[model samples]
Target: MLTLPSIYVLDICVFVFKNIDKFTRVEDTHNVNTRHKKRLCAPFSRTKTLSGSPYYMAVKIYNKLPNTFKTEKSPTLFQKKIKQYLIEKCFYSVKEYLEFCPK
Candidate 1:
């Protein structure tokens, strides 16, 4: 059966957190860090598909926000420019996250 190995999940979380400035209020670095720690501390379980996984659930929740929410993917050049501007405004405050692996 196909499943997302824990390493891939950690990488995705790191990527998401790093680029989180592109998305509005969906998650902060602290929140993502906390969730990552939770996942690391929890026991692993097999799932039938990646879509049923926690990562997918988090993405789904983020996508469900009202249209007013600013996400990395915008429909137009103007919106993209706007998003970039917003991200630049706060990028300095963001910190890098270290990836963790299970033994």
Candidate 2:
């Protein structure tokens, strides 16, 4: 027969498992793709951090900007505009931006 302490521990475990199932059900319908869409829709997506490394974040941000603003003819200007936008969005400090956007 199980002791009182053992029964209490089992009860707590069951409660946690049930809550976990509920949370998973709620999150499954709105997975990472849905979150990504919501992030993109937000005005601050360009400045937001990616799930991976800073390089990935920079590339993702670069890809999201309008093509008209990212012509090869003026790559420096394009980069400057992106940096300015990130700063305006209050994503990070100038130091952090430099660390993330290394040449």
Q: Which one is best on TM-score?
A: 2
For candidate 1, the per-residue lDDT at 100 reads: 19
- On lDDT, the leading prediction is 2
How far residue 58's Cα lies from its native spot in candidate 2, in Å, is 4.5
| Per-model TM values vs. the true structure | 0.24, 0.29
Indicate the TM-score of model 2. Answer: 0.29
Q: Give the lowest summed-lDDT range of ten residues in model 1.
A: 93-102
Clashing pairs in 2: none
Per-residue C-alpha lDDT of model 2 across residues 31-94, encoded as one tens digit per residue: 5554233122212345435434433433334334444443324545544554455545443333
Can you tell me which runs of candidate 1 are displaced by over 4 Å?
A: 1-4, 26-103
Each model's total of backbone clashes:
0, 0
Model 1, C-alpha of 100: deviation from truth (Å): 18
Q: Please, what is the whole-model Cα lDDT of each candidate in the order they appear?
A: 0.36, 0.38
